[model samples]
Target: MNAVNDDPNGDGPHHDGPHHDDLRYVYAVCRPLAAPLAADLTGVGGVPPRQLTHAGLVALVGPVPERDFAEEPLRAHLEDLDWLSETARAHQRVIDALTSVTCPLPLRLATVFRDDSGVRAMLEDGAERFHRVLERIDGRVEWGVKVHMESEESAAPRAPADAPRPSGPGSGRDYLRRRRSQRTAQEESWQRAEAFARELHETLSQRADDSRLHAPQNTELSRAPGRNVLNAAYLVTRADSEEFVELVDRTKDEDQGTSRLRVELTGPWAAYSFTGDEKDRAE
Candidate 1:
């Protein structure tokens, strides 16, 4: 991603040196805010984010050193786990703060430009798409819901203490029977999980403006207690958030002790999943 600048002070963000120029990083875009943001909010590179308005839209940006953000250097930085994590966290901090005040169209991390002109050009190029997105997602947020089912081993029943420890031949037969029973139970659990996920998504969709189904999460990466059966996002209005939350709560209660299934709800995030593909954002 390229980066931007429009420094008021001669010594601040954008550098107009003969050999080097600092870059501007865009965080998100939205309408002119009704009120100014909190004074202390900061973003990537530890710089405070400022609004740059063009064509009646606001692009939230901040400056970063060209030495670190310019093309070659940024590619190297992206490979550094610690650097990427820290930068991503700072980027998210600004977006989170914005979500509290407005429905912002968040750009991907590392959306940069060479100068304020470049940033404005991008806004000009993407205005129509941006406007459509803004109209679709205005006054709304994204909610994530994931359903996980406990492993069969965890849900399997234990043998009764009073049951006999059978002779060798009988013990082997009993073991085989148990294995077959476990397999049957596992199959049943998977089917039940699928059914529950579909039902839940359908119910939630009626209350949401839009819905997206994501691939189930990897158990190894998520480190959750069980396998994910449903991974979905819902675009819901702020006014209906409470009722949506209550609906989830009711489902949670209904799910209690049923195959040890669990429903996890996340966010009131900026309509990240609902935004259509935005071109010219990071190019």
Candidate 2:
């Protein structure tokens, strides 16, 4: 959905095209921050972010130019990988700052508005879910866990690395037997890897307050060493971070049956995956 200027307060026809006036770029929502933000912190467009309060919640916003951030221009800019990467980095930096200070409900990337009035409207509209989600995530952090199985070619067991390939099928009967045996072994290894992933996710879920099973990331995109078997997020209390991390680390065993398991863990971050209500986030 387009996150363009939605001036609900009859603020004239929505300002179209590039204009001199600046739009508000929202980063996150949270209860009133107790500590002050770092003086040097900057958000998208290199603009300093400030808080705007409404309905007992604070929204972190910064000014962005309409020429670049307006609906038509913004959609075009999104296609530029360099632009998207820089914007994402800036966005995450702001969210990270908020995470350090309080339990922030992070908005999706490019959440923009015409002005403070539009932002306030959003806050009032989703006030109920925002409060409910805030209460649920307060003082809690998210952790990520992933499991991968090393490529079969790299983890060969039956043949030695230095073995020479046969110039031809030395014996058709023997070649067929060897091929069948290799296929069987590979199938068994894959099955074992899948079972290992399930067991580990269950174990981690038992320790976390809430868990989300995210779709496995693409190998090409993630550059993961092997097939991504599991990708999950867990919500645990701040106090339980140490134990949760330790639990996750203990299961990163390389020797789990014939399947070489590669376990990955990330976080102690804001609950990015937990409070993803698409309807509310579309704002």
Candidate 3:
């Protein structure tokens, strides 16, 4: 939707010129390369992403209407959940495209500048910091690991001998006792799951150059069979990825018979978790 120009005059903050004196939506910054991105890769507003280089750093940017991308208008648009989600997806698409061929320093979603000169200025000012980060993650990729507690129903059915005796009619005391036992079992199960998650994270962290633990997602978001207990990211060199995967598989297999915790590994993504922490971002 057009973010401005609700009036009839039609002189909105939106720029309507070939020069595109509008705001620039920045997707990422990376080491200088000879060629541009693929023809299919596009940025915000469905515009072809362009490259701006300064001090050996290359920024991927695209023109966006100032009416929709300026500080105030952008903040308002972000409050619209649908708009925000779609925009975030679009932002990630650009990052993904760059990630496929280069180690891009992904900007946060909706990062914008007044023009290409502003982007160039940022690159000039932060050139050393950018290069340091780029070097650190040059040959590495990120992986995500999560552990969840398996649902009780999905576990192997209890054998007849292990099943609890049902409280007969008029057996109040027995019913109360059974309820207490069930609650205790559930509490113990959750504790065990947490312990397993910590153990798994520790094991995997040893195999990675850097590691970070993110808050576990809720059931609705995770959509997994069990309660999510651990959510983490690992930075591993491309050469060591296979060994890392193998270690995860072996760890999960060993825990299968002893615990109802399941482990999941996903990645080779841009090093989002290991980009030198939140403090390193350009303001």
- Let me know the TM-score candidate 2 reaches against the reference structure: 0.86
lDDT of 2 by residue, 125-191 (tens): 9889899999989999999999988888777757777898665656777788899998998889889
Residue 79 lDDT, candidate 2, scale 0-100: 100
Error of 1 at 12 (Å): 17
Lowest lDDT 10-residue stretch of candidate 1: 2-11
lDDT (tens digit, per residue) of candidate 1 on 1-283? 4222233121235422222476879999898776556666778867778777788778888878898888999999999999999999999999988888889999999999997788899898999988889988999999999999999777768889999777876889898998898788788878888999999999999999999899999999889889999999999999999999999989988844556789999998988887774453445
In terms of lDDT, model 2 sits at 0.83
> What lDDT is reached at residue 263 by model 3?
85
Give Cα distance to truth, residue 51, candidate 3, Å: 1.0
Error of 3 at 189 (Å): 1.7
The candidates, ranked best first by lDDT, are 1, 2, 3
Report residue 281 deviation for candidate 1 (angstroms): 16
Predicted candidate 3 versus true structure: per-residue lDDT over 1-114, tens digit per residue = 112111111222322332565787888888865344566665677766766667877787777888888899899999999989888888888887788778888888888988
The parts of candidate 2 lying over 4 Å away from their true place are: 1-20, 157-164, 167-170, 277-283
